[model samples]
Target: MQTFATLRTPQTTGLPARSGAGMLLMWLGIVTFYRIWVLPRLGITLYVDEAQYWTWAQQLDWGYFSKPPVVAWLIAASTALFGDDLVAVKLSAILLYPATAWLLFVLGRQLFDTRVGLRSAVAFSLLPFVSGLGLFVSTDAPLLFFWALAILALVRATSMDRWRDWLLLGVALGLGVMSKYTMLAFGASALLYLLLSPQRRAQLGNPRLWAAIALAAVLVMPNVLWNWSHDFPTLRHTADITHVEGINDKGGNVGEFLLAQLASLGPGFALAFLAGLVVAWQQRRDGRMQLLVCFSLPLLAIVFLQALRSEANGNWAAPAFVTATVLAVVFLSRLKTRWWIVVIALNAGLMLTVYHVRDIYRIAGKPVPASLDILKRARAWDVLARQLRPIFAAHPDAMLLTENRTLMAHLLYELRDMHLQHAAWKPQAIPQDHYQLTTPLGPEDLGRSAILVTQSGSAGVIERFSSHQTLAHVSVIAGPKLRREVDVILLEGFRGYR
Candidate 1:
């Protein structure tokens, strides 16, 4: 399990690994700079989720229909500071992840020592998805940052018992929750760790701990209030996705997620990581290992069980990797020396393939097969944007109409110059997404002319409009096997759905 990076734990009587800290700092700085300056301009358009998040940023609020407001606020802040350029839009993640890596360094140092800190930071920085994440901004960015900070605060508070550290822990957990609901696992893990440990179990009665938990609850109360006032859309959406009432018995999801980890962390790292989790269970009697195991394993175990019962995304347990990275680094450091180069080479190769696959295909005189093209989602959005630009420009007075959230997000973004706002068609008279929630076509629009963009079908819509006709059809070729097609319809005098 040895990796290229030399990470040696400090001996009781020997010198500490101070040099590793400086190297880690340098690496973090370089990664941060490159993501900030270079990656944003590399021709990958924002993902649908990123565009939707950007649309949410158009109006900053405590919450949204499907998720919390942290990502929206983050994109809003970044765009405000850097203008509406793509770089500006993606700047949050471009900055957040590197900063998260540094926080990982601090957390590792507090939990173990300087060497483990350095190894953890380096390992996280090069994690397979992180390389891709640098190019695409998402909610996971701030969630990971706050996740690490919260753990660091918890570990420090256990010893220092300072009000300041406890406050930090509360705020971090709260902010992490506001970033992604998955941060709730931190609460579960913290409880498991605090309850199981013998030396610190008495602290359960401590007022300070309760105060911290209370603060976290208070900090998240605004989002909860927002949800309540909005008919609990996010909560209902969460329940629907999670199937809280019952498990659907989706088979092989547990195995799918396990294989997904192999793809995500690479085979060597994934295997070693699974082995480390096993070791953590076996060594739970030791206090330090118990802390790591409780924090790392609980969330992972929860996600796996969810997979077994219903289904879980590969990234659902990402925060667990905050501690797992530290544990994995420590585990790998104990392996044979020659194996170090193998892991380093393996991870580095995977990273290169992720970052430059298109270039690799070009150099090899072969087009990337659509199925193998990871960038397909990010590609062709701008093309679709261009196709609809003139239609939007010509019908500036037409009520912009769309039935799909993805179409609503990208069109609104690309057509920002025209200040287009959509009249989202809600056939069911119920809001399924943010667009439908805030912008549903209503009775007042019964006589309004509109330009309707639909990916599904334009047929039979004439029943709703006095006169309806196809304006243009957009068929964009993204990759060899990827094509995005949509119907552009001009509808005069919309009839009320009722």
Candidate 2:
């Protein structure tokens, strides 16, 4: 027993140096299986944002009213492969997660040692953030992977002082921007970092950096033009959502922001990240990682201040987390083997706890009840889709009216494969049969009767429809979260008039 115990201790103690590569790969393989196969097979549907993006994919434009078109392009490509299946949409980015992990490995190896690289890769791969976002198609997935790649490229350029590295960085930065406008934070940071560092400042004189920026600009110019042509409404929409000049009733709580970081990264890894931040700040002379720290600190400060002002965006602190994880691996690699084991165990525990809480209801024969009434609408959407089809079929020329575009989008995605679809009558940001008839239907459009589909929450908007005759009412049943009775009204009789 003593011999067996002694043998096990050395293996455990030496794992970081001896088998770090194998351990990291094993962790990544688990993530691949779970994210790419397991959760998807359990019938997890796309969230509203996912559905909206899928709708965007159907439209295939350069820019969207709220976000860039890369996410839409990705969704379209995925759905084309698997016929609009939700799991298929998810697989689009599940494939990218590993690539990001590999880049994390490369970045860590380049910045520090092979062990740090492996540890960082393992931490990133197991991060609860990756696990959740990996399966959900969003702007963030590509944004994250591309951001890491850009950072890696920057790291390579700094270390090697190579023009190719600079070019690669520029290409990545552009792709990252194409993914999300928020990537501007990283771009600004990279430019600033290069300028501030004496060693790297010489490269600034090189045309490569400018060329990269130019390339990114060229790649992204179409979307920029689209946003410009559309009066930059997406910017205004984002401003409204962020409460930049509008209702700011909710202020940020430092305590809450701190807690959210813990939740997002998981308790175990969050501590390691925080530890790394403190180390980086204290050991400011470490030139090797000072560049990343410089890039990360301002972003972290902005995120912290924003959290204090209002509810911080969930992914707002993502870049900061990336820096913290890299630093943690570098610092932790110097610690004893037993300490590393404890860290790994703690991270494993955090992941298990989160999985048990969030994914349990799905497995235990208990349908997870949604909190908001709108989700109930999402829950019973297929039934509502069926109820809506015949109403549209009856009025061969009739238009469909909706108060909310999101609700309409949900309906559209659910019925995408079906033939007879009810068009939304609204001011569409995207080209679709979906229209808005909130203001009076135009004379030509009103020549044919319209079907109005409104949720219980927005049913008051029904007053606008007072001019149209109500032929029949279909009580579109919804689940608890939605507390919604989607009313699909037929207006063929046309008795009421303005």
Best by lDDT: 1
Q: Which stretches of candidate 1 lie over 4 Å from their true place?
A: 1-18, 36-42, 247-252
How does each model score on TM-score? 0.94, 0.83
The residue ranges of model 2 lying beyond 4 angstroms of the native Cα positions read 1-26, 41-43, 253-255, 342-380, 386-396, 419-444, 457-484, 492-498
Predicted structure 1, TM vs. truth: 0.94
Residue 90, candidate 1: how far off, in angstroms? 1.7
lDDT by residue for model 2 over 110-160, one digit each (tens)? 566566677788777667677667667788888878888888877766666
Clashing pairs in 1: 2-340
- Candidate 2 whole-model C-alpha lDDT, 0 to 1: 0.66
Cand. 1 Cα-lDDT: 0.79
